[model samples]
Structures are given as structure tokens and as C-alpha cells.
Target: MVSYGLEEKTALMTSLTDKLASTENSLIESTGRLDRIKEAFHRSEARYHSLEEMERNLEGYQEGVKSILLSKGGDTSPLAGIHGIVADFLDIITPAPNIPNRDNIEGELQAEKVIEAVLGERLQNIVVEGQEDTKKAIEFLKSNCAGRTTFIPKRPRPEKYRIEGKALQQLSNISGVIGPAMTFIEFREGYEALAEYFFSDVVIVDKLETALNLLKETNSSYTFVTIDGEVVESSGRITGGISNGKSPGLIQKRRELRALKNELLRLEREVSGTEGEVERAKNEKVLLQVQIENINKQIHEETIRIVNIDKDIEALIDDEKRIQLRIETLCLEERGIDSEISNLSSELNIYNEEIQRLLAEQAEGEQEIQGLIESQKLGRERWEEAQRGITTRKLELATRKEKRESLSVRLKELGERIESATTLTTDKEESLSKIDQKIDGYLREKSGIESTITDLWQKKDAISKEIVAKENERAGREERQRLSEEELKEKRRVMEDIKKEINQFEIQKAEIRLETGHLKETIYTTYQINLEEEIKNLNLKDLNIDELTSSLTALKERLNRMGPVNLASIEEYQELNQRYEFLTSQESDLTQACETLHKTISKINMTTREMFLNTFNIINEKFQYLFQLFFQGGESKLVLTDENNVLDSGIEIFAQPPGKKVSQLALLSGGEKALTAISLIFATFLARPTPFCVLDEIDAPLDEVNTERFINSVKDMTGFSQFIIITHNKRTMEA
Candidate 1:
């Protein structure tokens, strides 16, 4: 029974030992698998976070689209009609349950790059409900002075381009050609029109060569985009290149984000499964250990029993041998006493009875020894089983030691990886710090350059004004010189006239003297009185030559036909000469005053022109700078309607926002006009900062992002100017 029990226990122990070995191996494998799964899970999680962050930040979106998305606050009313950008609606072609070949088709087509290449910049285009929404979005953009963007209406416009049936048939026949580009993409329900609008004339091919072949085989009215993002235009232009993976396109990024999310989920599932497996393996290991301990305990108890039985059988054999030796000695004594047999017969019979009892006891001792031998054999078998169990345990221990070593190695590797990661992180941080330092240095340099430019602009304006003033002064001097020359010529003419009059007067005086001489001679001949002596003695207050001549003519009336003369004519001539002299003095004074007044007016006009040109130039430079700031990039200037007449010339503002044509202020969109006007105002402020400024809803047209910029600008001016801004915008109010 003990042997049978030992045999059963040995079998069980052997089986348990095998189970324990397998469990240990399984536990080791499960632990390794769990670690791998956990590592993969962490990696996937990190990647998912990175992609999520990228999406959240709108990293690849255009400036205008980013602005729009960022400015759309919790309230959806303003952006209610907006259906997001075109890229948002596009997705990778998914395998449909009904289509067995869908995955194959999807794999063959590079949907992301193909769509990205086909859509081009239109991926950033905002989709709107209609023209009204487009108008609203435009207004929003203009108000914010955000960058410009294109808009696609939800209501599809008439299709102006369609692939010809014959061309389609020919394309289908062409090898390596996918169908229309639209067929490889999936979009939202209402965005079918947009898809069609953007993809109607585009075809997809597997390669550039295939595209070229297809183009040659068919009418050259289709634009083909290859799977590698190469493009073949209908106008016989081909563009093909490799892309550096630094900045993956927006569509590619979106695709990667989705893939990352799915991968992360899968990793999470795998991790959970692995963790469960590891737990089960550990539990099994614990149960096997318990079973092994119990088997060893049973083996130990059976060995102790076998050892006790062997000790008992040895003691019994010793007693049996001693009794046999005693019986032999008694028989020898009885043989020597054979002659006295009669006398010792009774004693001998008693001794024989004792011997018989001793024999029976010896037989019983042998039977017990045989049973103990059988028990020893069973115990020996159990000992061998226990030895096998020990061997298995040693193997298990070795396996466990190996597992521990493997875990240690894995841990060491993980530690090394962590150290390397830490080192890499440190290096990245150092690099980032260096980059930041470089950026700061560049910013400082940029600021210095800006300041220098401003100073240069100021110097240029000052020099221009000085030059204008000098020109005006030179012009005035030339004008004054011309007037002086004309005045001197008139004076010379007057002097010549005076000389002619003087000569004529001399001739007339000579003739009068001759006449007087003749008269004197006649008088001397007739009345013998010297005329000179008579004239000197006479009181000639009223005496006139004509009157005297008349008297003489009367005396000799017939000698000459002299005209009649009045004596008061001499006084009248004297009065008229005095009046002419007074009038000439008045004319000279009036001319001088008029000349002074003309000079003053000219000075005033010149000063006004100088000031206007100076201010205009300064404002123009500022406007150009501010326009570039507000619109991100563009050109703008203040033009004079009439350069010849700066003082009275009208200023025409010409502005060109980034990605737009140069247009007059009136021709720009409302938001563009607002931004342009705001830029002008800011430029004016910068040119001539005021002590205090009042802005009433100036930011009303601006979105949140633009309002933030406006606020920042306002803050920059707070050092020199005070601003009173009236606004309803939350961002503005918060600022």
C-alpha cells in the first residue's frame, strides 16, 4: 500500500515538475512579451500625442486659414455658415465592406499626395454656404486684417470643365492609369460639388510616364497628377520632384494623424492582452511552485518513513543473530553433557521449547525485514522520483535564473535607452537654446536695422525738404532778378527820353537866343536900348515869352504870325508839374508794397509744399512698413495726384495686400480697406505720435487674432501715447 502510495505520489510529482518547468518558461516569455507590448504602446502613445498636437496647432495650415480657425471662439454664430477648409472634408479612401478590392485600390493610389497635388492651395480654401457667407467671411478677414484666403461655395457652380467621354474611354484603356482623381477620394456629403469642382478636369496615373503616355493618347485637355505628386498639365508642362520629409503636406499630415490614432488604439489593445497573459503566467507559476513544494514535502515524509523502517529491520536482524548464536552455544553445551542426559533431560526439554519460541520470533523478524525491504524499494523509487523532481526544480531554478538574467539585461538595455534618450533630450534642449539665442540675436539685429532704416528715412525726408526749400528760394531769387532786370531796362529808357528832351530843349533855347539877338539888334537900331539891360531891370513876375512876342508882333504885327497867350498859363504849368511829381512818388511806394506782399505769399506757398511733401513721404514710408506688418506681405504707397502742384494735389493711396493686385483704396475689399486704413492710421501715429488718441470700435472689423495684433501695437505705443479704445470684442476687452 505504501509502495502504491509512493508510486502514485511519484507520478504526480513528476507531472507537477514538468508543469512547473513549462510555467516558468511561459512566465519568462510572457514577461518579455509584456515588456515589448508596453514599449510599443508607449511609442504609439507618444506618436499619437505628437500628431494630436500638430493638428491642434494647425501647423500646416496657411496663415489666413489659421487666423480664421483661431478666431472662431466658442460662439459659432459668426462662423456658422463656414464648413471648415477643404482639407478637413477630405479623408483617405477607406475599404468598404461590400467591396473586396477596395483595400487594393486604396493601396495603389497615393490619396494624400494625389489630392494634395491636385487641390494645391485650394486645400486651405474655406467652404461657405453661399455668396453671403463668403461675404461675411471676407468681411471677417478684412476686419481682422488677417491674410487673404479663397472661398468655395457649398452651392456648386456650373461645371465649366468636363472630361470628354472619348477621353475617359481612352484613359481607361491606358495601362497604369487610375480613373478620375475624384474617384480615389472621399468627402463629406454636401462637399461633393467642391470635390467635383476641384477634381473634374484632373486625372490620376500611377507614374509620370503613364501620365505622359495617357496625355499623348488622349486629347490634351486633362491635367494628370501622378501618385508621386508629379503633375502634367494640359498645356504640355510637366513638374516632377522628390519631397524632403521635413514638412509633410497638410493632407499627408492628416492621414498620418489618423493612422497614428488607430495604431495607438491597437497598441493599447495588445498591451492589455499581453498584460493579461503575463498575469496568467505569473499565477500559473505561483500555483506550480505550491504544487512542487507539496510534492517535495510528500517525498520528504516518505523518505523519513523508509529510513525509520530500515533502522527497525536492522535492529531486529541484530537480535535474531544474537538469539541464533545463543542457541548454537546451548546445543554445544548439551552435547558435552550427553552422559548425564538422563539427569538433565527435563532441563533440555525446557531449553528446546525456548529454542522453538526463539525460532518463531526469528521467522517473524525475517517477514518484517522483507516487508521493510519492499518498503525500502518503494522508498527508493520515491527517492528517485524526488531526485527527478529536484533535477526538474534545479532546471526550473536555472530557467528562473536565466529569466532573471534576461530581465536584468532587458532592464539594463532599457536603462541605457533611457540614458540615451535623456542625453538626446539634453542635446535637443541645448540645440533649442542655441536656436533661441540665434533667434534673439537675429531679432536684435532686425530691430537695429529697422531703427537704422527709420533714421535714414527721417534723414531723407529732412534732406528732401531742405532741397525743396532751396529750390523754392533759388526760384524766388531768379524771379526777383528777372524783375530787377526789367525795372533797370525801364529806367534806362526813361533816362534816354530825358536826354532827348534835354537836347531838344537846348536847340530850342539856342533858336530863342538868336531870335532875342535879332530883336535886340532891331531894338538897338530902332530904340537904342540894350535888351539885356532892360530885361534885368524889369520885374518879370508875369512876363511870358509868348506875351512879349505878341506885343512885339503887335508892334510889328505883320513880322510874324504869333499865337495869342494868357499871362495865367505860367502858374497852371507850375501846378501841373507839382501834381505829376507827387503821383510818381505814390506809384513807387505802392509798387514796393505789392512786391513785398508777393514775396510773402510765395514764401507761404513754398513752406506749405515743403511741409506737405515731408509729411507725405514720412507717412508713405510708415504706411509701407505697416501695411507689410498688417497684411504680412504687400506693397503700398501714397501717390500725389499732381506732382507739379504738391500743395493742392490730392493723395491717392495704392495698396497691394499679399497675394492680391495693387489696387486703389476704394477698390479693396471692406476688410482690406479697413486694414489698409488702420495701417494708414497707425503709420500716421508712428510718424507723428499724439499725446492722446481716441479709437471708437476701430477693432470691430478685426477678428480675435488681428485684434490681438492690434492690441500689441497699441501696447507698443503706450510708452509715448495714450489710447482710449472703444471695443465690443472680447479679445480686445481682455487685452
Candidate 2:
């Protein structure tokens, strides 16, 4: 029995241990399941939330795209002329093949040359205008020229009009002579003028050389020679008028003639001597000719360069023609490309529109799907909560079952002990007697154990009640979890259906976009219009108009805040600014002028002030004596009271009556103040009177005693200024 009891005890302990382990394992498994369900529910919730958000964003985006499309006007208007000009300017200014090259300068030069040559060949002419002698001279000239020259008409000068449009004047004659005869009769203008007659502002000729040659051959015996339009004459070459009828006069005249003839003979001899001079002149002329030749060579080189430039110009013109042809070809190609671009632009617009529509439809569908997804998330959360409650209830039931089993085993053990003790009592009487105390103690233990069993039974009953409540709650939670799960599944199924619908809508959208693209391409190709560019331009215009309206409103508000602007005030303000500026500038000038004046005046003042101080000191010494005559004994001095001292200081007259201790001007009477003030002003004036001073009633307050002293001082100051005195006293005025 002991062994059996021990075995039962060990088994019971092992069972409790196994039960606890199993419960722990089951709890772990259930907790893990619950955690996995919750994780799944969270992921699903996140997916549903994201889908809902995306649906909302897509809806807003779709609306924005529609508004953008509607804002742009349809392609219905042609571009303005200025717009075309702007486009052309952009195309021409861009670095493209169609722009004219810089070599166009050469082409223009070639055209000019051609025009000039044509004009020249058409206008060249010849003329002749003299009688027999002139003809004989002309023949002589022509023969001597040896085919080297041709005659041209001479242009009239301003002074020549007085001489019947002739080319010669009394002071200056100009005619061309292409000859070597060295005769004045054979002179005529040259031929180059005829070819280019009307083109020049001035008629050019070989006037200097011809003038020198004409002077040499002329009949006048004065032998006037001009070079480069300047004349140098020797003394007394002109034959002055003679006094007639006197023998001496006639002899003198003959002597004069003889002398003139002798002078001519001497000049003839000198003319021969002039071979060296001529040689020297010829050498100098050779140098000048060389310079002229160099200049002519340069001119000829320039002419040839001009001719080559003309050839290059012709080549460039030809290149320009070729380029124009190429430009035309490029324009044709560009037209074709423009047509294609127009078609593509229209097609792209249609695609964009269809894309917009599809996006809108997709947004609506996705919104519905998102709503379903949100509902599903709520359902999943409910299901998860319910599942947690069911798991908790199951755990509670398992725990209650464990406690009940423990209670039942204790009750069975107590009943078995009572039965075993009654059977063993008679067989072991003596042993039992010895164990009576132990039995009493065992009885007490039994009672305590029974009470414990009763308490345990009560506890078991309470636990059973809790288990029933838990079972009910668990069943309710299971039902709720099943219902929530069913709803979640339904929402998921609905979402899937929506997704399928969206896929179908997407396919429809793709088909519509394709058809729209094809239709747009057909319409664009037929119309040759850039619908997309038109729409883009319209969009820009709309944006600009909106911005302009906003700006205008803001400007109006600001204008309102500022109130009415006074135009006259504005003009006056402008005038004032101008005047102020002028004044400021004048002030600046005056400041500089004042600085100079200040320096000069300062010097004058310094000298004059010092002189006045010295002179005042001397006068004060004399004035003080005159005052002492009135007061018997007194001291007087002049003092300055300010730094500038222009008006601050004055002459002071101190007087003390006989037997008085002090001498102060304040101690004097009113008549004395007037007399003393007048004397001081006069003495100060004697120092520096400037131009003029006025005395108004200077002796009105003075008595006769002091008035006499003031009059004497005024008479003393008469050397300094022109004084005007307003006084009632005739004696004072007379003084």
C-alpha cells in the first residue's frame, strides 16, 4: 500500500508537471498564431491605406490635368504677322545653312563695277570748237602729240561765266594741250573728262604744267611766271607811263627802252646761262616725277585690286545664287518636316487627352477600391481582436480544468484514507493503543484536511463558474471573429473585382488612346496644323492673361491705397527738385566763393581790426582826459568782449567825481548812460566807421551837462563817416 501510495504520488506529480509543460507549449503556440494573424492584418491594413491614398492623389492629379487642358484654346487661329516676323528672325539668326554669308560684300562690289562700266561705255564723247588758226594750232598739236593724246572740252570756272562761259579768266586761264609744240596757241583740254564728265564735283585738269608752259609762250613781255598758283615777280619789270614833250623825257624814254632792250639781251644771255638751272630743275622734276610715278603706281595697284575685287564679287554673287537655290531646296524639305511635325504634335495631343481621361476613370475606380480596402482593414482589425479574445478564453478554460483535476485528486485521497484506517484498527489493537495520540493528531489532521478539501471544492466551483463564463465569451468572440473574417473576405473579393474592372478600363483606355492617336494623326495630316504647339501656346497665353489680371488687380489696389496723384504737384515737385539742384549747385559755388571771400575779408579784417585797436587805444586815452574834465579824475580803456568782436565790444568811459572811491559807468545817471553810450559809439565809430551809421535820438535821455560832452565826441567822430542823426536838439544836430 505504501509503495502504491508512493507510486500514485509520483504519478500525480509527473502528471501535473506534464500538464504544466503541455499548457506552456499550447500557450506558446496560440500566442504565436495570434501574433502572426495580427502581423498579417497590419500588412493588409497598410496596403489598403496606401491604395486609398494613391486613389485620392490620382483623383486630384486627374482634375488638375483636365483643368490644364481646358485652359488652353483649341487650334483655330493663324499666327500674327509680328509673330511670323519673330519666327523668321529666330530662324534667320540661328546658326543655320540658309543665312546669307559675309562674302556678300564682294557680290555687291561686283554689281557696282558692272553698273559703272555700263554707264561709262554709254557716255564717252568728243568735241572741237575753233576756226582756222585754232584748227592749224590743233593740227600742229595733234601731229606733235603722235597719237599720245586726245582733246577734251574744258569746264568753265565761276569767274569764267563773266567771260561768256569761256574756260579762261584774266587772272587764271585753263585749257588742255596734248602736244610738244611749246606754243600757247595749241592748247586744249584732255579726253578723260568726257568719259567721266558728269560724275565729278570739280573738273580736274593738268592746270599747273599747262599754266607754266602758257606763261613761257605768251606774247606779254612782262614774263610773268606762275608755279602752283603762286607768282614771284622781279622788281620794276612793268613799263610805267612817261612824261611827254621834253627832250630830256624823250631821251630818257629812249634810254629806258634801250635799257629795257639791254635787259632783254641780258635775259637772253641769262636764258642760255639758265641751262644749268634748267638741268637742276630737270633733276628736281625727275625726283618729283618719280614720286608722282610711285603714286600713280599705287593708284594703278589699287585699281587692279579693285578689278580683282570685282572678279571675286562676281564669284561670290554666283555662290549666293547657288546658296539661294539650296535654301529653296531646304525650305521644301523643311515644309515636309513641318507637316510631319504638325501631324505628330496633333497625335501627341490626342494621346495626352486620352491619357487624362483614362487617369480620371482609373482614379474613380481606384477610389472605390480604396474605400473597400479601408472597410476590409476595419474588418480585419475586428477579426484580430475577436481572435485574441478567443485565445484568452481558451487559456482560461485550460487553467480552470487544471485546478479542477487537482481538487478531485485531493478529495479521492481523503476518502481512501478514511476507509483504510477503519479496517486496520482491530488487528493492531496494542499498536493502535500506542498510536491513539497519533490517531487523535491524525483526526485533527483529517479535520484540517477535510476543511481544506471543502475550501478547494468551493474554489473549484467558482473556477467552474468562471470557466462557463469564459466559454460563453470565447464562443461569442469566435462568432464575431468568423463574421469579421467573412466580411474581410467579401471586401477583398470586391476589391479584386474592382481591380479586374480597372484592368479592363485600362485596356479600354489603351484602345481609345490608340484610336485617338490614329484619328489625330489622320486629322493633322489632312489639316497640316500643329495642334500640340497651338495648345502649348494657348496654355502660355492663358497663364500670361491670368498673371496679367492678377498684376493689374494688385496695381489697382496699390493705386487706390495711394489715392489721387496731383499732376500739378508732381510737376511742381519736379520743378522744385530742379530748382533745389540748381540752388545746391549754386550753394556749392557760393561756398567756394565764400571761402575765397572769407580769406580775403579775414585778412582785411585782421589788418583793420588791429589798426582800429591801436587807434581806439589812442582815442580812449584822449577821451578819458575829456571825461576826467567832467568828473575831475577817471581812467578809461577800450576792450573787446567776443571772439569775433564785430559787435560785442565797445568803448568804456569811466569817471569818478571828486572825493569818490570808485569810478563805474553803472553808477551814473540816465543822462550819463545816454551821454556815455553816445560817446562810446562815437569813439568806436572813429575806430572803424565803414560806410555809414545812423543815430536815432542819441541825446533824448541826456541832460545839458552830459549832452555837451556827447556833442563834442560826435564832432570829433565827423572825420570817419557820413552820419545821419535824428535828434530833437538843434545844438546836437548842428554839431
- Residue by residue across 1-735, what tens digits does model 1's lDDT show? 555565576567667666766776676577557655654655466557656766876866776788777655435657677878988888767541122223333235557778888777888988877898788878877644456789888767856476658867766666676777666677888777777777888987777877888778775678999878889988898877876656778888777777878887887788778768877987787887788677667666755655565565566556556655655554455444443444345544654565565556556655755665667755767666655755655565565456546655755665565566556556655655665565555445445434544543464466457557755865675466446545644654675597689679968975886677568656765566977678889989877889888888687765455544455687577658756865785587478558646755876797778878888899999899888978878999989999999987898889988897757787787778878889899989877666569999888887766677788778655534568988898888887
**lDDT (CA) per prediction:** 0.70, 0.45
What candidate 2 gets wrong by more than 4 Å, as runs, is 1-44, 47-49, 52-432, 526-735
lDDT of 2 by residue, 148-246 (tens): 212223331222111112322332333442111111111123422232332221111123344345445543222222211122112323211333523
Q: Judge candidate 2 at residue 84 and give its lDDT.
A: 11
Segments in model 1 whose C-alpha atoms lie over 4 Å from true places: 74-76, 95-108, 164-166, 213-219, 321-735
What value of lDDT does candidate 2 attain over all alpha carbons?
0.45
TM-score of each predicted structure versus truth: 0.43, 0.19
